[model samples]
Target: MDPHDRYTQNNFWQSSQAANAALTGCYAVLRYSGVYGGAATPLWEETASPNAYNYSNSDGWNSIAEGLQSSTTGGIISSRWANCYEGIGRCNYFLANVDRVISIDEATRTRMKGEAYFLRALFYFLLENYWGDVPLILDPPDPSTQSNLPRTSRQQIIEQILKDLDSATLVLPLKYGSSDLGRATKGAAMALKARVLLFEASPLFNTNNDKNKWKLAADAAKAVIDISSSAGYGLYPDYRSLFLPENENNKEVIFDVQFIYPQEGNSFDLICGQYNSNAPLLDLVLSYEMKNGLPITDPSSGYRPDSPYLNRDPRLYATIVYPGEVWVSGSNKVTVTSSWFPITGYAMQKLSVYNSATKPPVKASDIKDGQSYINYIVIRYADVLLMYAEAQNEFIGPDPSVYDAVNQIRARVGMPNVAPGLTQDSMRQVIRHERRIEFAGEGLYYNDIRRWKIAELVMNSPIYTWKHTLIETRRFNPNRDYWWPIPQTQLDLNHNLVQNPGY
Candidate 1:
């Protein structure tokens, strides 16, 4: 029996409304579990790094951190691959058919195209970051011709990603009105470009220590920094509030994945606050500098062993829930106990909505499962500043601009500026440390360590609890762990697919 009025690819793009809805479908992919779709998956990524520990292996990150992942590893390794390709497919379909809707205005059509280009580039960037060389599919899938595609060179994919980002910047607006707040913008495209260049220039990918690559990354970051004010981007005044639901789309956010409660929400608060899935490790807790911008190891740092949490960086109080700190849930003041966090003795406070200062504290019962609506920030101004500082320091010696960029971030948290006259080597150490502390629990350290070729050094060490009790030993084989293995299922489907080395 033939269907009477079903919409197919040929009939769907006949109107502007349908085309717009199709474009929205492309954005919906961002919410997928493997993507930034939910808070748990993104924040749980910290478990794969030294910043945090995962009590369970259901999420797949713990295995990766323990260097136990293989081609057959099923959780995140497989899902991330599938999700990125799904997003890429949606983007390809939208780009191929959106122009067919003649009712759309010329300017709107170009802008939508720019948004699609930006999204496609974003998906490919994720693929290249994790899988190294992924199959680059530009057009809508045609089964007969595309079923057995070979992996494209990562360098080639990155070149195309840059091209798409450049095209997006040329056509996309700097920012949008409130109605379209989460849509891709020129600033977002530029910021993503800078991140891509910085990763490409890192030691993992740039083994030769090419100064030119660092210069390129620095220049790209500077371009975004130069336009930041006009584009309405800056550091949000309060670091903790920046992740609160009410403060979403704030000035600090360059790009974020939108989530609305009761419709499409995430389990970030429940998992992080109530369940404590990703527990902050003792290694990361000790990384925060003293209030005066000195390491705890320093003789004059004023760090007392008995009062380890006091007189520390202000950001520490804003980001972590340690013993003795009161955690308010529905008017109930519960001081954290040693048994509160069984795995690491710490919980993250950055992305949860449980502020103790609210007139009526939000009830943990209210957001028990997936009722939270806080947007996951993909890129922010503070990150751009850090990127700029790191890239510039690598390109040239510790310059004044490098110092200024990093100092701005420190000053935001009321911490002292880094000392003057630091040599390039010293400045490198400072910037790397700042990144670990500044972006902790944000799911970035895993990549930072890998790109810096320090994952083996860090991950091979033993993980411990707050009391210095050994939890478990970790291993990182530099030959295999840096690039995740392509999923075993994908290889089974395609004869041309080859597994990553040592997997």
Candidate 2:
């Protein structure tokens, strides 16, 4: 069966339902499986490590951050950008053709169309976050239109994305049933819209503050929060379970890029973990507050860096590894670096899937099986909470609910509650820090800093200085380094496209 076939089945709305399936395939490329293959796994590492990304076939992940002159990691990034646009074209194809679902009701047709718009926007959003000034191509332009096309302004691309989100907001149901677990919903649309607005209001895009941008972001987030508390979307009881195979269709996931072992899910983990140490930095590990809301910096916390595991939040144990950390591995001990080391020395363990009791043991032969089969989260409820806090802080000046949001996350960790009477600026600092710790190693850091327009402040410092060796250390070069130069191949082929500043 050709998975790439334009159409496979007919739907009630599609004159030929096969078209909708083919169209949805456009969104599937974002998954761990699909067109880009196992190499896409490098993205998470690239975002998290540089010096540590070296080993075996892991150089690609390192090169992305180390600035290799010409590398496979660079190639993966290039191909990913191109493939994403191909997906954009597919969505354009559906938006251009969904009218064919003859028997479909007006409502279904509208919702389907809305899904397409959301997908297209998502694709562009990915591009915007990475390359900054990417060419935004809308619609399936005729051959005549292609030759004349040039890069579109980032602002223009954002405008188009907002239009799509607004369209999605009009038709999707608030929630979907079990069978429709992975499908887009009104909640997903709103969460994404709020995120986009917050990104826009962020220092990266809004640069000059522009009052209205912040207000719009606040309003968008408020709309989601208004419904989110009552909506079924929320955090899972076990933070570790969020990444486990058993939690594939959990309630906490807003939208996940579905994957199936061998078939759709290839060796994403086996390849990513080959030799590279996907280390989750120390700042990220300690950000989880003491169940009492106090930071590890609090003297009352009795947080012994030596015995960090004794009384810290459970999530710390779930998401990170400190000395003596042990996970099941066949008959071997899956040990963590000894606690003798400093925080950054601890490696990230959030994606671990090594238990043999409840699940199949990792086969030395089939590395993929050793990894979890859970779907990769494309967007989760936790992100919405962060977005809500960020937007609210920016608009409302760190209201009590800001602490409410932060504490909710801390509560799960069994830490003390955060102190009240904090300024918006101070609370925003904590949220940003907390997000770094919470979402570490999940492909968020780079974008998080960029959106905050604090890339220079964060990346400009010594980023990955391996304390033990000269083998890995890097300095962020802002002028020529912020964005990868347009792929050399694209530059050679598309004379119409221009490179970003200082590239």
Candidate 3:
């Protein structure tokens, strides 16, 4: 018998250890490049929106941003589709066989099954968001029967996703021991459910202006907020420290994809800092409010065009490395002509651990590829608060609860409370703008613009550098660009698969 092939398919699921290993395999898929794996994959997603620009076409996001994406748009379009289904297949196999492990305790088995359900739902959620309709394969793959499966409606897939989350919430623990810190938890399931409901209720999906859908979304988000204390979830006090590796699994983080150096690492610092692959656009930089919580365009806001970076939102300084900004150390300033960043004249500062404050400061030469191990936060308490505010405001104007939720986020960063007694339409813009500033460089803006159906307006404009130099003019087709084309390779494999319109 071959020592490497110690167990065959028939014997693999017979023990508790084997069952755990199988479940772990399901989680491993999240680390794939197509999924939320490396720093580049998630951060590069901003390139698809107006928040950032990718200088190179190698990642496929530059092409998509330029309105040049097609069935052959190979990088993210193909990988995301393939990796998500690959995750689904692994989860399906684990769920199908884990029950065979009689050595496991009933409670442990239940929790393990809950994890499998959550992973499957997450993978499906990615598919629903990007592809709209996809092959809903819940069982272990059988080439004979599953090879030619047709697309399932997104509504049906969402129903199944919610069902799985409900099941997960019942069995997953509110908190795990330190040894299992990064595993899925009950709070994570509820938080993900809130996000799913909010997206479903958005204008992109609920086209009839359905108030009831917004209420469902508001209630779902409120449910998570209600359990925040018991679940040990809240805003991490310092905005800049929140992304540091030392702050991983902080109270603010509801769910995050964990990474560790040597064993498992990412190229976040190298690609985002040195290469400037995902450069913050001038449009995003200008969206930040002044220190007094007023728009820069406001006459009384104290935002000077010449000294643009001074007296800006604190989060702006925390998130972006602009020209003349102190970078690695207090004395090390980023000059305008620095070759380290030449794309958009701005580089991402968040999610990198190379600052002067460290015991041994990390220099530019010290940064290496696939060595940064910062955990990528997927959902957090701040997002829940934002979702609740947005959904509730849409459902019943700007209620007191809406004010409280929005104000809490602002208070954490030392900004003033949202202006009192604003009309519903005005408050809507406030919540949207707050999200743009709050979640900048975190890869959420692209979906926000799409769900709000404002992509055509924002993405069709010209992207510029900090000096107001035109970088490129982007395009967004209202009819087809809203949904990416199914990969042409997938179409070749499955004749039943149809391409999205305008491809």
Candidate 4:
């Protein structure tokens, strides 16, 4: 008569309807609990969030930043894969069991199916980028159904993702209305699919030179633009406003995982997590082109690299709190001076609680500390705009509409117009640079560089800079580091599971 025993399938389909609802709860856990983790998830964990302008961690020209690990285990990056897949399994369980809810109508049933498909695609997208060739569990197995979960081909996995996304898009509502603004939408599915295609076609995955892959990516992104304009999505009035508490669930966001205040335990508001390490990297802070739509590299450009953080993109100021910005933190209005970066040279105070009334009092515990309710932008209109431009430029050799899309993003930030007749290489460079600025500290740059195929060189080579010392000798370990290794534990469980190349 034990209650836990009921969760098992003793003629599950024939009797237990409520158990299926419990399954929904399982999928929801994956939907909710999995916030940022692993190297892919920015930890900015090492830097001390300074309230005043002074470099206290005086290594002089050097201070140790956090990314080094224990020689025993791979540390966090190894553990995240297990956590990601447990949630994936839960989602897969939902996918396998949802059909049992015969009481629901076809429309309701299909919507649930669509949600499942989207969740799977999302999970795989994260896995592919991080782990590369994850064991693709399309449906939940009966405990004994499969003795081993084989590693799916990364290409086959991508193909499956595209299929899921396409199905989800057709069923998901374009508008969630006021009631469900942050949930995934048809536009969200389309944009993510487009991004996936772009990644697949890019040098990151498409080992073979297939021009059709680029065409597919372009077409998918264009579909989102063709449809999303009519939906209630436009650029947020100000790029700075995009991060404010007042801007949560703005028109721009197609989907975001909403976080809440005084949020206890592991949550999306984890930058302020233990050690508060996930600070903005300096490369990200300096990459923003001046508001004139020209890069800092341009000789005529006003921005000075030595004084790089000053007078640059408005987004740079809004997203990152640098050495000398007088910013009000919470109701206390604590002035942040230069001590922000003891080692890393920047502070990410952007996603912190901005509103006075709703601000989660900075808890003393790192897990719950300084976390805010600002919804994370899973897919935003600006990203969709950029995707359209990048895809179109690659597919059609720099279409004017592509210019318009890129320019609109610039215009939103008060940047000068994108030049007409810019070449593919120039525009591609511009987009890559803009992405570093626009999505800085949002955990996109690392992937953006990787997908652009520049990371093998950029991440591999070292430059001696004013702040970082260790990076001068660091090389991107393409063999074992580009994609994280499949968790050693997962590999042990599934004999058929193959590790990625090298790792």
Candidate 5:
């Protein structure tokens, strides 16, 4: 097993361990620069939305935030396209060789193959979400014969993804042992299918406004919920504690970009320091409702402008560090002060482990050495519930099941549910708001806003801080900005690749 040897007939498929490592190697692509590879994972997408602002020139995110991205200029634009293909290629290669290893048991081999299929589908899903249509390479094509390819329609690619995921669902197990914790499972495949169906059924892609599309999405999500009892999936009790390392494999997480410390891993807390990379903005802070289940604009909501942080939803405190929040650093309880004068006058607190006597020491040594071991949760039960609520509402109008699903989320965070009886349209708005607040710093808002057909409406306007201070004005060309342009390097390498319309 020479390290430099290429994956071939002579090596990598001879032993059960080699087969498993090769399969694990396919997942390594998730750690590529544009995906969940680095500390600024959330910023790569968050800055592109109105959710957060990269005040400093820390990364290429600020350019994306301003909507000044060009196919050639924006590094993330190119990185995302290339990295996803890299992951897909590994998956293809693994799938090609998985059956060669006869040393592994039938069940183990099937599950390994299932993981590869799910990962390949996931890579394609990421590509389609960012760049609407992309080349669909199902196998590792020979360079001499298939060096160039053309983009496939997003719909066609989605159908392929569903096919792969369905195959995956049959082979993958419901759960794995703790040692094999982060591997893709049957629920992971089903949850991802639900997500893909929901996105495909959104306004941005579902241009025909088909009611059946919404029903399809709703049914896919419900499929995951139906097996929740046996699958052992539910929301973690404390919202704040969910992101901590000790709770990495909690019941809430359906699937995650797996990571560990003192190995090939994460640097989330360090990058989101005082000069936070994915810093929460005032607009997001204002989006949280009062403790009494009312928007700030409502007279009975008891939201005070001057004391904005008081008596708010508990999640608001969990997710953001405002003027007076207490922050712990190596046994020292330091008050959060905005000394750098962040663009939005706020700093990100989510995904960071605060140092305290009760927890492991999260001091300077821990952060400097990249020892933060928090796994970035890609999907969780909370998101599944929200997706089910949204899709079900759109399909059959406001039903009791829809209310129960949403109320489950609200109850976990100790917030009041929607007023007893509401129309379908109003409940839609409620679900939308819940997603925004619930997933504030988690990098899902960008896709949520875009899919809901409101990116132009929210992004085009000037964004303000908590005190009505204008921070940034964004540009979103509804006709063109919905999908990022395919990278120029890709177009150069393959002439068949067409540039996105606006680019």
Candidate 6:
């Protein structure tokens, strides 16, 4: 609630609507323009990955991608740190004050508090991903006491996150009413915990390659799958249309940053602009396999460089605009190049509502208005399935459950299932590839490559566009690039702050 609004009603928290609004305010943090909201968001972190690149060096992600990120680097690093902590602060404030509201029913109060907890854990998770260790503040900070709080280890933070999610599951409802569609749920908490555990068990954190850790991660994911029906969670049928605004609250979505153009003054179209920013890179285009479930590089796959877009994975058409692809802008049917020229020769088609068959799709005008309502999905059922496949494959070689999970994802997009009797190592490769294509432009690529320890191999070479146009000779200093430096401004604010090594 705004301070002016609070001033008008001295006892705002005593009213149910006002109290609910405070809880809603905690959620408002997720819509921060720099994180999940506007053009450059957490997804912009993808630019640091080999999956995509920004043509402009001034682009925020380019600094981190090119190994120039420093304590003073004020793009994604500082924005995320500031915004995420802002979100955590909001959650803290809500939790500290919500108890004083007597008008809210006990059930609603518990659920609202649970949502605040989940949102807090999520903000911390984002912090840990970029900057390895961060100061863990549960309650609203007391300037008197927290003026010089030190950083907490990532492992301890993860433990606290799991505790929050566990507590959340005990009170959060299985689903929310339509009026409260985008609020967090029990399934979302579980799914997020599964993701954290999987990341915690990965090579980066689990340097010992402990099988027990993988089993723990697999079990956590399986817990989410086990509650699918009760939680109203399943795969949405149309892979291409899943991100559309009309399908915002589908069963596949566990948690999403809700956005509505004009109403919220936020646009997904503007987030991934025409060709100026966040364009699909050539390396990503080549990663998609053929329709027949064979890689383009395989001799028997029937891939021809001269006509590369033909007979490729169905997802490729749904994801990128190849040279000859038809693109609809307003009522005009024109090739993609006429409207947008991708620096990498491949324009982004994911999350964009355009088609040659229909002159004005329901969302056509939103793009032109810089107003799109597509909710940015954070955790979806597909991710759970893929995480389960990865964890289970690591825990025990290929098994029936592993195939069952992987096959469900393939069936949704009309792709053939993995052949039976594959070794654990082979299945690992398959699961990794499946995740790459299934979530191409969704911001998970950076997390995957980092956890799998493959960023250095892929990012150290010169990158070219589809037309062999050289874009950049990327650099990755493995010694210091894995973790971003603590912001210089932050260090100056708190003398207790410690910078990451090599900063």
TM-score of each: 0.97, 0.85, 0.96, 0.83, 0.94, 0.94
lDDT of 5 at 304: 88
Q: Rate the local accuracy (lDDT) of all candidates.
A: 0.88, 0.65, 0.87, 0.61, 0.81, 0.81
Query: What is the RMSD, in Å, between candidate 1 and the native fold over all Cα?
Result: 1.8
Off by over 4 Å in 2: 1-15, 33-37, 42-59, 67-73, 141-144, 266-268, 271-277, 286-301, 328-347, 355-363, 369-372, 461-471
Summarize candidate 2's per-residue lDDT along 241-326 as a digit string, tens digits: 77877787777787677666655664544432332245544445556666555678989977786666666666666765555666
lDDT of 6 by residue, 73-170 (tens): 77777777888888888888888888888888998899988999899999999899878888999878677777688999988898889899998989
Query: How would you encode candidate 1's per-residue C-alpha lDDT over 1-503 as one tens digit per residue?
Result: 43558988767888888988988888888873548855337888999999888887746888998999998988888888888898889889999988899999999999999999999999999999999998989999787877799999999999999999999999999989989989999999999999999999999999888999999999999999999889988999998899888899999999999988788888887767667878888999899889988889999999999989988998888888787777655666767776866777888877877565552234556665667778889999999999999999999989999999999999999999899999999999999999988898789999999999999999999999899999899999998899999998999888898888999
Query: Model 3, 1-503: lDDT tens per residue?
Result: 43555887777877888998988888888773548766336888888889899897646989989889998878888888888998899999988888888999999999999998999999999898988999899999788888888899988999999999999999999999899978999999999999999998899988999999999999999999999989999999998899999889999999998888887788778757777888999999999999899899999999898899898888897788787765444555444343547888888877777442432235578877778889889998999999999999999999999999999988988999999989999999999998998888888999999999999999999999988999988888999888889999999889998777788
**Ten-residue segment with the worst summed lDDT in candidate 3?**
354-363
Poorest 10 consecutive residues by lDDT, candidate 6: 356-365
Whole-model lDDT for model 3 versus the true structure? 0.87
Q: Which scores better on TM-score, 4 or 5? A: 5
Query: Which has the higher lDDT value, candidate number 4 or candidate number 5?
Result: 5
lDDT (10s digit) by residue, model 4, range 397-437? 77788888888888887888877788998888777766666
Tens-digit lDDT string for candidate 5 (285-304): 88888899888889988988
Q: Who wins the lDDT comparison?
A: 1
What is the overall TM-score of model 5 with all chains considered together?
A: 0.94
